[model samples]
Target: MLSPKKIRHRKTFKGRMKGVANRGATLEFGDYGIKVLTCGWITSRQIEAARVAMTRHVKRGGKVWIRIFPDKPITKKAQETRMGKGKGSVEYWVAVVRPGRILFELGGADDELSMGALSRAVAKLPLPCRIVKREEL
Candidate 1:
């Protein structure tokens, strides 16, 4: 799982997802990309899984760029514990993803290879996503 080397804060409040992503909405590093179509918290585990799938599918023929980082800490209390005892410890990290955010980009691969790899990656993600090209931006 992805985590910060050193975090200033251990726990944080659940923030709201207000709008579509304005930044990182376009592909900057690759000709093919995966665009997030829904707002949700993407866990580091999921990200890694998707990355592995993509790389394996592409046979390492292309370069991949992960646009989002799992920097936000998510806390969870012990099961069956009391309701109130301050916040729980940080359990995992997540990236707050919004609609229009480009999560992954692939370069150096042909159209067919990129599409196959990206589609495999999409299956590993929790939210619905669509494959896009740099020209589509």
Candidate 2:
């Protein structure tokens, strides 16, 4: 799982995740990428799982880039614990993913292999995603 090695804070409030992604919407380091279609919290484990799937599918054909990181910390009190006992500990980390955000990118791979790899990555993600090709400008 991808996590920050050091952090200034341990616990944080659940913030809002609205509107489309303004940053990281276009492909930067790859010819093909995966664009999300919905807004949600993408866990670190999910991101790693998707990356593993893509790498395994593509083999040695391409270079993969992960555009998102789970910087936000999610807290859980405990299993069946009583409420009102202050905030819980940091349980996991997540990335706030909005529509149009590119989560994964592939460079140097053929069209078929890259697409297949990205599709396999998509299946591992909880959010609905579509593969996007870079448009020459």
- The model with the greatest TM-score is 2
lDDT of 1 by residue, 6-112 (tens): 88877888999979999999989999999999999999999999999999988969999999999999999988999998988888899999999999999999999
- Return the lDDT, model 1, position 85: 82
TM-score of each predicted structure versus truth: 0.95, 0.95
Per-residue C-alpha lDDT of model 2 across residues 1-137, encoded as one tens digit per residue: 99999999888878888899999999999999999999999999999999999999889989999999999999988989988989998999999999999999999999999989999899999999999999988
Best by lDDT: 2
Model 2 gets an lDDT of: 0.94
Which segments of candidate 1 are over 4 A away from where they belong? none
Worst 10 residues of 1 by lDDT: 128-137
